[model samples]
Each structure stands twice: as structure tokens, then as C-alpha cells.
Target: MSAGEPGTGVRARPRLTVVSGPSGVGKSTVVAELRRMDPTVFFSVSMTTRNQRPGEIDGAHYHFVDRARFDELAGRGEFLEWAEYAGNCYGTPRQPVLDALASGKPAILEIELQGARQVRVAMPEAQLVMLVPPSWETLVGRLTGRGTEDPEVVRHRLAVAEKELDAQGEFDALVVNTDVKQAAAELLTLMTGTAVRKPWSSS
Candidate 1:
């Protein structure tokens, strides 16, 4: 898909939707569900310097680049938005997302708060959606329950979550992820600009 061409059966220009949240807020799970329900949505696969986790397939899950390559791309301004998280660099490549949108495919980006802000500045037309947990305690429980990180790391993530929650008003919409099915449905409605009412409105 290239810029300026509409995808099959899509007459309008595609929009770029950014999905961001604190770590361990079930963003991945929610996004997975969205993709399962609608495979036509173009989900941008980020390039990351972090090690690949189990069950994560390269090119499908992430680009999985090394630090050197990641730095090279960042230096050359190849990314639409990029940020460092937990010492690892993660970024969305510019060309692919542009191409997807140009081809009239709805593009979704799952990235961090900083990266989301960058996209907001660079692409003002992009829709910014924030996924929030039901509560702080619930967020902590979900993070710890994942068992993927050390206790110290979990603690750090929770701290970050607190800060992220405070920034909820910055997004175009906020969907509380207390129920995965409900939240996913809300997200779908948000992306499609349907009639469903969002829990939090854009400021």
C-alpha cells in the first residue's frame, strides 16, 4: 500500500490511531483482541532494542532490532516517534505508517506515553487513545500478576503507571480496561468514530 491510494472498498482517507498506556495495563491483550476481530486494521509493528519474549515472532510482534541499528534509525530521523523505556529503545518507523494511511488502511500504534506525545505533535490529525486500568491497586495487581519482571521492576512500573494515569486528559479518549471485552469494543468504536459513548471525553 502506498500513499494517496485508497484500499479496496475504502473511499475515505485512513486515520492513524495511537494506543498508549502504562506498562502491564493489558494493552497488548486488548490490541490482540482488536486485531482478531478486525484483521484489516493496520497495526504498526514497532522496532525495539529489547530482547524478544517467548511466543513473540519477529516482524509480527516487533521488528526486534539491536541497539546500534535502533540508534542509527533514530539519528537519521527514520522514526515517526520513538522513546526509551526501561533502558530499551522502541520506535515506530515513519514510512510504513504513512504508506498504510495513504492506502486507506486504518493504522494503529501501540506505544508509550512519550512516543504518543511525539506522534500528537508530528501528526495532529492522528487520534490518540489511552487505555487505563480500573484503579491503581488493580493496576499494581495486574503488573505483579504477570510474573514477567523482577519485583523491583514491577515497583518501577507501578510508579510509572501513577504518572501515566495523571496524564489521561491528554488523550482524545480514555477507555478503562476493567473488562477486556468491553474495553476492546469501546476501542473499536473509538477508532471507527461510531455512536458508542466513551467513558472519558477528549479535553
Candidate 2:
């Protein structure tokens, strides 16, 4: 039975699902699809010091901030977990997640493996779901297909992907994102209790 099944005499706890995977493994695409499928689900927008890529919205893709501001926030302990990847800083704010959970809403966070580990430390109840590519070659193709970053940045991410894949055992569940629609459907079931029906209602 799921955690919130009725008649179990157990109070339901809001789920904090941390969706993590190697860079370029379609984490954002799968997440965007999840949002499209279920708008009510809350996804934590992380704060980043990296420049926004083309087609990325300031507050949507991430809370893009300057290095100084990011450093200040980190120093002030405003973030739940923070990490520097490929020379850019990324972190999840603590308050919004806590507020979402307090309100009995399922919260989702898309972050790197390191940040996911930190989140695990802070919120042991949080469900860590790892989204993985079908194959290593598939990962390389996805990373190169973006054509957004420098060759060196791509290489660095590729190297990190190796370690990320090796650490998949750390996550509570593994969702292979070979198809965005299918993967998103699986993720929606994890976030909510229901599967992807035609109407897509969480009620």
C-alpha cells in the first residue's frame, strides 16, 4: 500500500520528492512535462549564479542571481543545500519547501547529485528519485545536442555524469527517462498517488 492509504490509522505526510540525475539527462524536460501534466504539484525553483540559457525564464528556470548575492545567501544559511557545478553555484531555498510541506502539498526539487545528497541529510523523509538516461551513449548525445555550453563545460559535465550514474543506488527510486511523456507520467505517480489518466486529475 502507498504511504497515505486510508484506514491505516496513519496520518498522511506530504511528500518532498527530490528529482536528481546527471546533467543533460533531460531532468528539466521531464520536469516540465510533469508540470504540464499536473500544474498543482509544487516544484522548487532553485537559485543559481549561472547565466540563464536561451529560452529560460528568470524565476521559472531558476532564480538567477549574481555571484555576490548567491554568496551572501549561502553565507546567511538561506539555502537547504548548495553546490558548485561547472563553476556555477546552485542551491535550493529552505523556506519554500518547508512551507509547501506544511501546507500538505507534494514538493519536487530538481537538483544535482551533490545537492540531492545534502537534501537527504537535511530531510531524511524526502524521496530521492534519480532520472537516468537509457545508456551512456545516449547521455553523451544529449549533452552534445544542447550545444549551449563550451566544449570544456560539456566535458566536465560528462565526467560528473559518470559519478552520478555510479551513485544511483543512493536514490530511493530510479526513473529512466527514455521518453519524456512516459517518464513524466511515472514521476507524476510518485509525486501524487494516481497514475496518468486521460483527465489527469489529482483528486
Candidate 3:
């Protein structure tokens, strides 16, 4: 079929979507679930200076780098947005996201609130969506998981989370995460305008 023909279904021009939330709000889980449901979605992987953990693959989980290398890249302005977290630096490489969008694949950036602000400045057209937990009690429970965290540490985390949650109004969209699969499907639908098959019928 010729381009833009009446019978040919034209694909929507994919856009860049920035997904952010509090530290323990299950943003990673939802993004992973979205990936499982649709491999075509372009989830932007970040580069970090933190040491890779046991199960992390270098290029997959994150592009692990030394502090000096990270600094060099930042100085050259290769990152769309970058920030320091827990004494380590993490940044989204700008080109890959542009490449994915130019080729018509929705690109998702699973980042922190700080980085999301930076992205807003760098790419004003990108969509910003915040993932919020079902409730404060649930977030507290998730933050205190295993009960191994120091009371002081947990308190600090909750304090930060409160501030992050307050910034929901700044976002273009909000996804409440009661179930990982449901939230993921909703996010995918928002990004693509196409509903996906639910993993299970009853839920």
C-alpha cells in the first residue's frame, strides 16, 4: 500500500515518556512488566557509576562506568539528564532515546524525580508520568520490607517520598500502582494507544 493510503493503517509517531516516582514505589517492577508485555517498547537504560550487583548485566541493567568516565560524558553533555543518588551518579544517554523515537518506538525513561525535572528542561515535549503506590500505608510497608532497614533510614526515605508524592501535580499523568500487571498494562496503553491482553482475566 502507498504511504498514507486510506487502507494502510498509519502508526502513530512514537514519543518519549518519562516515568518517575518515589524510591520504593515499584517503578522498576511496572517497567519490567511492560517490557514483558511488549518488547517493541523502548525503555531507556541508564548509565551509572555504582558497582553492579550479583545478577546485573553490564549493558542490560545499567551501563556501568567509573566516576571519571561518567564525569567526562556529563561534561560533554551527552546525557539528556543526570543526577547523583546515594553518592553515585546516574544519567540517561540522549541519543538512544532520540533514535528510538525517530524510528517510531515509544521510549520510556524510568528515572527519579530529580532526573525527570532535568528531562523536562532538556526535552520539553516528552510526556511525564508519575507512578504512585496505592496508599501511604502500602508505601510504608514496601519501604520497610524485611524490617532490616534502620529506623532512621526508613524515616528519611518516607520523608523524601512525601515530597516526591506532592509533586504529582507537576506530571502530565499519574498511574496508581495497586497491581504491577495492571499498572503496567495501563502505562503501555497510555504510551501506545493500544490495549494489551491482560495476563489473567480475573483480578
Candidate 4:
């Protein structure tokens, strides 16, 4: 297939799906729930230059690499999508996603909005789902409740979340994340069309 939207001759549902939202939008929570609820799908693990957080396992949460290694991989065209966030670079390895899809399994990529845009240009046939918070107030609470970052960092994230929310229309679908399980179910259904949805609907 070409690196664009499929022609009229194509009928199969896209095997690749990109999930993106602003920081502190419960993306990690939803993804973890999705894994527990559906083992058949593939969730692409991203590589990042940021130091691993407490309780995070390398290769499970993210493949932690230094700046030089990350730059070398990016230069080699190994990343299908990549971007810098909070001064750290994150990228999705190209081959694993392709291999998963080639094996007839749906692949879910959790990335930033910038990387999602790159995926749209590179794989237009793939579905782009924008996950959002129930309301602006809830989003602020979530971002601040983490208490991991400084006040300045929290403000920056809230600003970025506002911009990401404005671009919701660019997505193929919108998923309001009121609860983790429901959001994951919605994402799973969007990818494979056969998930047992919980009690939640898109707004």
C-alpha cells in the first residue's frame, strides 16, 4: 500500500490506530486498561530520552535512551513517528508496528498530537482517535493532582492541553475519558470493532 489514504478499491478496516491527547489526559491509564481487557491487540512501546520514573520498567513503560542514541535512531529512519515534549524526544519504532499489523493483529499507538499528525501523513488509512477529558475543570484537576511536576510545568501542560483540545476535529473519532475502563473499551472498539463497551458515550 502507498503512504497515503487507500484508494476506492480497499475495503478492509485499518489495522493501525493512533491515539493522542494532551498531557495528563489519562492516556497511560486507558492504555493499561485496554491491555488487560484485550490481549489480542498490540500496543506499541515508544522510545524516549527521558529518565524512567519510579516503578517504571524499561521496555515496558518506555525504552529509555540517551540523546545520542535517540538521535542516531531518528537519523537512520527507524522511527515512523517522533517528537520532542518537555525537552525529551519520544518515538515509535517502525518495524514492530508493521510486524504486528502484518501478523493480522490491530496495532495501537499512543503518541503525542505532533506524532499523530505525522502518522496521518504517512498512513492516512490509519484511524486517529483523540482522547479528551470530560471537562476543562476535570483536566486541570488531573494535571495538578499528579503533583510530580513543578507549578511552572503544570501551567505549561495545561496550556498545551488547551491547544490539543482545539484540534479535536482533526481526529477521526473523539473519546471522552470519564472512566479508564470505558475509554479503553471505546478505543478497543474503534480499532477492532468487537469490544464490550462500558457505560459511557462520546460527547
Candidate 4 per-residue C-alpha lDDT over 1-203 given as tens digits, one digit per residue, 9 for 90 to 100: 42322343433444788988988888888988998998888989999999999999999889999999999999998998999977999999999988998888889998888999998987766788999999999999988988889999899889989999999988888999998989999888778763322335231
Q: Give the TM-score (vs. native) of candidate 3.
A: 0.87
Best by lDDT: 3
Q: Which ranges in model 3 have alpha carbons more than 4 Å from their true place?
A: 1-11, 194-203
The positional error of residue 89 in candidate 2, measured at the CA in angstroms, is 2.7
Candidate 2 — which residues are off by over 4 angstroms?
Answer: 1-12, 51-56, 145-154, 194-203
Could you tell me every candidate's TM-score relative to the true structure?
0.82, 0.80, 0.87, 0.82
Off by over 4 Å in 1: 1-13, 51-55, 146-150, 194-203
lDDT of 4 at 42: 90
Candidate 1 residues 40-120, lDDT tens each?
A: 899999899999999999999899999999999999999989988779988999999999888878889998899999999
How far is each candidate from the true structure, as Cα RMSD in Å?
5.9, 6.4, 7.1, 6.8
Model 3 — which ten-residue stretch has the worst lDDT? Answer: 194-203
Q: Candidate 1, which ten residues in sequence have the lowest lDDT sum?
A: 3-12
* Residue pairs with clashing backbones, model 4: none
- For TM-score, candidate 1 versus 2, the one ahead is 1
Q: How many residue pairs clash (N, CA or C atoms closer than 3 angstroms) in each of the candidate models, in the order given?
A: 0, 0, 0, 0
Clashes counted in candidate 3 amount to 0
lDDT values for all models? 0.84, 0.86, 0.88, 0.85
Q: What is the lDDT of residue 152 in candidate 2?
A: 98
